[model samples]
Target chain A: MSDPIFTAENVKQHYLIRQGMFADPIVLRAVDGASFVLNRGRTLAVVGESGCGKSTLARMVTMIEDPTEGRMTIDGSEILPGAASRDAVLRSRVQIVFQDPYGSLNPRQTIGKTLMEPLLINRKDVPAQERERRAREMLDLVGLRPEYFDRYPHMFSGGQRQRIAVARALMLDPEVLVLDEPVSALDLSIQSQILNLLVDLQDRLGLAYLFISHDLSVVRHVANEVMVMYLGKPVEQGPKDAVFAAPRHPYTKALMSATPTADPSRRQERIKLSGELPSPMAVPPGCPFHPRCWRASDRCRKDMPTLEGDAHRFACFNPIEA
Target chain B: MTEITETPATATGPAHPSPLREFWQYFSDNRGAVAGLVVFAAFFLVAVFAPLIAPYPPHEQFRDHLLQPPFWQPGGTLQFPLGTDPLGRDMLSRLIFGARYSFFIGMVVVSIASFFGVVIGVIAGFAPSWLDTLIMRLMDIVLSFPSLLLALVLVAVLGPSLMNAMIAIAVVLQPHFVRLTRAAVLSERPKDYVTAAKVAGAKPGRLMFVTVLPNCLAPIIVQAALSFSSAILDAAALGFLGMGAQPPTPEWGTMLAESREFILRAWWVVTFPGLCILFAVLAINLMGDGLRDALDPKLKRS
Candidate 1:
């Protein structure tokens, strides 16, 4: 009923690949025509193979890279493309938690300084003492001892560092958090802890999450909705329950079947697709996923499939029956 | 996902060794580095109290005692323990006074070079475009010349004074810092933390200076230490060539120059100033090596 906290319409990001002095520059569409809306307290998990533009989409959401084409509205305010044109207020509304725990936090900065930076930068009116108090509070909120504030990033374990990263993102009380594979780099045991922390944080703060990951099991636990991307384009999107139970697009069905299950006896029939992912620079003409898609037909090769339907939108000439 | 056990948060208090203490522990492990540090501290103290500690005023030459050997030798006295220069200035006194020149030049040149170099380098790296191209091109042109040669030219143009020599040495050293900082900034610019800072509404200046500059400091600090010694060497070289710290100034390089004619007869005149230069440079270089090893994250103790 209420307006979504974040909305993207036909977003596209293309990077110019220059081969040499003579060759014409090729346009590599890293994220092509991705459309989604995420409401407050909801998680939109973007699942795709490596180089499927999931991270690029996250970059667009975080406003680190502007979409070459499309309109993105954060909390009903539009985000412009150029560096100078970017709205600082809207930027403060959305923050990102990066993948590598070691690389994400500045190694030279103490945890207290790292956590206090966003607050100092975004909330300039806040006094230094107040900021310090808030940083200590955030450290406690993220399950870290306040005394750890003086410690540098290297002192913390990977999971603890990720928690610090999440805390830093929440320092400005942003409406949205773009998590780009936040737990993919962690060990299996630590993965669940971070996911639980994320879920708990989202529940407490009512924050929208654009969760980008290649790990389906992790997505299944954290995501309310799922969007499947192929190459650079989305092929399927729907509520997580419906999508996981009955994946409509052939690509989504294949992905769901490929996900490893704990019990061997409960394994479903595997649908392995053939061939490596088509290069984004030279994508198939009609359907981006056609080269590797088993269900791809002449019609699928001749014309692109547009997403249709209200609740469970999918783009495929031959979608699986629910 | 449901089997999450809360790991009890351990308070990181006095029980945990601080990074400074850890650094010291590692630093103290290297005997050569500790010796270098002690030697450097001795030189620093001598430089600071050269006037009070030296047996005689640096310029108060003992014409009668000219060319005296060390105190251990026949002609040397306790008052002129290191003996007198060709100018009859106390060798020990002049050597003590010369420490101030070496240390002063090293500190001043490195400070000036690093400040300007880091500012320009960071700006060029963060705002890469025509501005970067222009700055880099200018640096390339400057770098193409041999650093000492460029210093020579600058000193020539500036007319051979202590201040001129300092400025010339700084000019010679600026390109190195610029390149070092630019390379560091360029690498750090694309890192995820930089992007995260941008997403968190950090302005260009804050992102470059606050987020990125601190990360680039380790290499810069190491380069600064190494450059300090080089600055001292270059200043001494200029003084030797009669372009810096002219007559009666008691600079080590001038002492060496003045004593060259008397070297065959009065060995202490040239030898002591030369040894002073050697020890000061060696101590600084060793300390710099230790710092590089200590600050290097890859070498951190497991």
Candidate 2:
């Protein structure tokens, strides 16, 4: 058992979008309710489709946006909905690596400046020479050369820039790092390199990671725990080996079956999900995934099921047999 | 994780030329631009050392050489090289001094316009929707009036003077910078780098001025160069209308106005001052085109 450093209880982010001048504003539940505890030295992977609010979850944890409704406890410091303080004390404990390395970095800033920005903004006590030293140290930690410090973001390739991004995130010595599709923008060969660097950084720093990605294969390699989401709500969540071995929720099963493997001799049936994700503006009556779930019965359409079971939790009326 | 061995993709990219050299490479690619730059440089130097370069005082008259033709002509002398105006003031000396006024007008007007425009624009871009709308609509209102008419009105209100003319021109030209900067800021504000800065504990002020502003500079730089030439033109127009630099100021436009009756007789006063204004505006516009080509990455041919 690991120590829980940050625990988010029933966190929700609902955006109010006004369609027209006369019509009433619609509430778009981007992240309906996600409750999970991030423990020390462990990676919790939030796996979902394009608009399942994985990035929203990461944004909430990284303090980019305040949650519409939630109670987050990070090391005794409480964060409430719409009242999340701009206090650097709590913010300095968490950092983020955004997707698109080219876009995430300030083009005008040099690598050293990018790495040093977090400290400059947050840690006022750190001296200039010490900040430079720490920045150079993190660069080497992320497998970049010392001379790359003075270079601009446009000069580096996707992989090198991702390395720089990772290095920049670690400058504040954050306890938690929210990695939002950290390698989704990189090449296939470069993805593994960044992944390895992330794993190495986690081990050395003992950092808790909230890794958000749609890629299952990458998630399987990095995550200790997995949370499968569909339409802003978690469908299944459990230990990495258990969820992959036996996905109880229909949505989770479909997602797990979709993960492509390179084995030719072993045959597996791919799960085909019909139709596109429904518009978040108008969700169905009962269970959000009921329309898409194969085991959808009359009961499932009327009443939504709560997440059950002790270790491997699932939210489904009729779950698949493990 | 196994040892990953692969050189970064951009490592092979044509040995990274310094940014200045790269800019020059693109700038010099256009032969017209190089010629324009050379001509602009000569004008700049002439402006800088006007007193030393000119043959005589710009205001000093040579009554003996009144209405004289160029030195190449029969009646002309080397002392009055480009010939004399209706008042016997040397056209060459006045034209040299006129360069200094043009540079001053352009610099002051552009600086004032861009500084206020960028500040207001950046604030508008980062402001709430209502504020942004209010600022944009106000700018639109300013743009609705014919620019020269608006400038003339401002100059008239301020009472005809050089400083007042420059200020009027700046106010008239400000809408362009505001529109340009606001557009740039609107596009660049939602970018990931700014978001990253916010996540890294950057305050709103820091995000607006430091993080987002620098990335939105390329377009503004191009717009600034184009505006610089226009500012000079507007100032000249004001001077021509007697709402700018007053009588005997040696301003190109004032010179043209003073020698208006001499157009048929002297020819040198009108022709020389008109040529100075024409060549200066042309050269600056050419350099601005070069700036647009070099600064805007999309317009650069692969």
Candidate 3:
């Protein structure tokens, strides 16, 4: 395989809960030892329920946040913690599209002003007229009218606002787009429009996506690969077809069963896990998913499972297929 | 629209309108703002043209007209329609002349206090560290003192004069502006756009001004309006206590103070100046309320 556009190795993000000045801090492992790779022109969708540290992972990948213990690289440059200069280089190469389109764009600013911000910041060498030309080109590429350059964010609908956001991100001609639930905030129909737009843009621009979301169905439509997470840990990851068709991890199975399908005639057997997700602050010993895992054995509880497979990987010793 | 990928023409600033056209658009949409602005302009006119219009010098005493009522009064003269004070100075002339001093104090005090307060607040809020601790604690110490009492102490120490009163009131009022600005900046600091600006590689200075400060303007503006009226009231209060503009100066508060002895015998002396104070404060408060409503983005949508 060719060099991946981005790679995250054993990423860990621990949030400290300070009780008092003198007291010892309790560390919550929000993202624990998660790993992934994104190749050029391919998308890797990280899916999990809320609080699974999926968004944290996206922040890390985009360099908006730094992992407590891990190494993340874009192309060949390693991202350093608190190194603003290094981060800017990483930021120019990769951009993020936020969830709320209404809030993602500044209300006081016109679309033209908002889009020009990134280009002006990154490409100061480009002449003013050349910059305007590039901004208009970006707007057109995102399927917006050139006249909308003067209109404020309030004039646009949810989908159109998202389109503006996408256009703004594209101003720097970034290679990687870190979308944190980009389509989840829109209506079902509008979600498809945005998804299709993203796919079309990807094909045209040869972009890679680190798509973070909680919806597996949405991921299935756009993701080339899917990584399932449970309580800040990656339980399973594989090609989109292989993972969705035959999920090995029990949590993944439970999540898939919970998703509502459109076909009313088809009856799918449901798998329900017992109890709520345990707090990351007090994550249990050995296998973290044992409390709800149906196939939890003595060995599963005593020892942790590591990612062990060929191209596909699962951290579950008692995976269903196995 | 043509799918103009990689085109160079579209990235520049939008078409600029002439200054006259831009002003017309801004003012037309802001009629209420215009009305408040006009009332303030008239006040400015009164301040500027006081010397030209006053029939006599503000402090020049006419011994023959002592205790004479206003022209509209039963025994009032046409030359002094607003009548004379106990010192026999023209009430109308003195009030007109008082405009220059009052406005000077109001603007200078507010400007000084606002400048120092805004700088302190923005810096404290943006830079969260030992500096924040030092600044916030200093603000808290200042806030612990009652503003009027602090001004009174300051005026006593500085020796009472119009300029001294202004400096004292400004020092007393500085903490409130700092509190307002810090609150505004603190909340705006976490907004996603500021985060976006950071992600765009904006430096600390650019991010503070371009992203954070603009968003914080609405609240700061409202605070400034509220502060102006309160500052005016505090200045009048200081004058009433004889620690402000002093006797024969015809400042509203000093007028009230000097006329209180004759209030029963010549009620117009106190009533008109009190009315002026009342109208000015009410008008300022009404405009402030209007600004608070207009500046709200949620209210704008409704």
Candidate 4:
């Protein structure tokens, strides 16, 4: 296979939690170790519950948050941590679609002004008039009318605001779009429309997506491969078909079983996992998911599992098939 | 997610006028602002046409007519509608000219303080950690002293005069504006528009002015209106204490201070000028209230 458009190697982020004035600070490993790669024209979905550090990993890949250890590279250049270089590279080649569509755009700015923001930032040798024309085209591409250029953010509906956000992201024509729960905030009906838009945009632009979300259904539709995270660590990953049809990791199986399918006639035998996800401050002794893993052996509690296998990696030594 | 920007709910509700028309709409909707405008206009007129309106030249003392009462008083003359002070100057004429002095002081002081404060505060707030820390620390050092006390010291050092008083007050007032502006810019700096501006590769200066400052204007404006009253009060207080405008200048507070000893013999001397101070401050506060209400986002929601 050709070189991946973006690749992360053993990315980790540790946050320092201060306890007392002069006391020693405790470190929470938010993103223990996450590794993933996205091809030129495909989406890689990182699926996890809240506090699972998927969002942190997304920030790391987008270079918003610097990793404690490991490196993330886009094309061939290694991205550095500090504000100046990270912001420059992130702004031009990669853009993030924040969670809240309403909040992502500045309230005071007009929609046209909002869409033109990234284009103005990167400049990219595009002529001013040509930039404006391209911005107008992007609005059309996102299914918005040309007239919205003068309106403020409050004037747009939630879904429409999200569309503006997506259009703003594409304005730079970035190679990678990091979507952090892009449609989770919208209404159920609106979610499908945004998903369809994303799919269509990916196909047309030949873009790569680092799709971060907790919703399995949306991921199944848009993602080529999926990585399941627990307590800031990836437990399972593989081609969407292999992972969904025959989930190797117990945590992955538990997550998929809980997702409600569209077909009412087909009843899934849901596998209920016991206990909440352990806090990042006090993750379980061995495997991060061991406390809630039914298939976890005594060794799973004593020693953590490591990702093994090719194409379809399962971190668990005693996976479901075992 | 695809946000449909073309046909927003608010976009179709009603056609909005151009920005100028929008400003007019805002002005019309706010009745207190209209009333404030009227009062300000009348005051401006009084200041401009002081000679035409006052019956006598301000310093042309009438030795025979010392301590003359107002026209409504028992021993009053129609020639002096408001009355005359112990110095035999027409209170009406002095008040008119005094309007010019007081209004000039307020505007000049506020403008100077606001301009410098806004620039410093925005720069401090938008800059990185070390710079922000350094600027804010300097502001804190200035803020450690009471503004009135600081202004008094500056006036004493600079030599007491109208221009010196204005400079003194502006010097003292600058720090407050800097703090207010810095806070306002800090709150607005994190907003997505600023982020967008950065993404657009806007220079730091352009982003601070074009993107950040406009959003922060509401609070700064409200603070300015409120500060106008304080500036007036401060200038008057300094004048009353003989540290501001010298004798014969007829500022309201100084007039009150001078006439307080003769208040029983001539009530109009102290009462009229006192009333002027009270009413002017009250009107400005009410105007500030109206402006705050109009600019508030919470009110817009309902």
Best by DockQ: 2
> Candidate 1 vs candidate 3: which has greater lDDT?
1
**Model 4 vs. true fold: TM:** 0.90
> Which residue pairs does candidate 2 place in steric collision?
none
Relative to the unseen true structure, what is the C-alpha lDDT of residue B88 in candidate 2, on a scale of 0 to 100? 86
lDDT of 3 at B215: 66
Report the C-alpha lDDT of model 4 over A1-322, residue by residue, as the tens digit.
Answer: 4348888889999999999879889899999988888887799999999999987887777665679998888886677776534365554777778788866777767888777766666675777888889889998998987877777777678899899999998888788998989999999878888999999999899899999999999999899999999889999988899999999898898898999988999998999989887789998888988888887789989998899989999899788873
Per-candidate Cα lDDT values, in order, are 0.86, 0.87, 0.80, 0.81
lDDT of 2 by residue, A1-322 (tens): 7778999989999999998998999999999899898888999999999998898899899877888897898986787543334577677788889899978999878889988988998889999999999999998888887877876777678999988888888887889999999999999999999999889889899999999999999999999999998888988999999999998998988987888888978788888988789887788878988888788999988997888888789999899999
Angstrom error of the Cα, residue A37, model 1: value is 0.8
* Candidates in order, interface RMSD in Å: 3.4, 3.1, 6.7, 4.1
**Cα lDDT of model 4 by residue, B184-250, tens digit:** 8888776655654565456787788878787777778887887787888899989888898888777
Which CAPRI tier for candidate 2? medium
Per-prediction DockQ scores? 0.51, 0.60, 0.34, 0.39
Best to worst by lDDT, what's the order? Answer: 2, 1, 4, 3
Question: Model 4: runs farther than 4 Å from truth?
Answer: A1-3, A83-90, A124-128, B1-7, B11-14, B48-57, B123-146, B185-209, B296-302
lDDT score of residue B26 within candidate 3? 48
Q: What is the lDDT of residue A307 in candidate 4?
A: 92
Would you list the clashing residue pairs of candidate 4?
A121-B199, A121-B200, A121-B201, A145-B6, A160-B3, A160-B4, A162-B3, A163-B2, A163-B3
Sort candidate 4 into its docking category: acceptable
Question: What tens digits encode model 3's per-residue C-alpha lDDT throughout A161-221?
Answer: 8988898888888889989899999998778888988999999998999898888889989
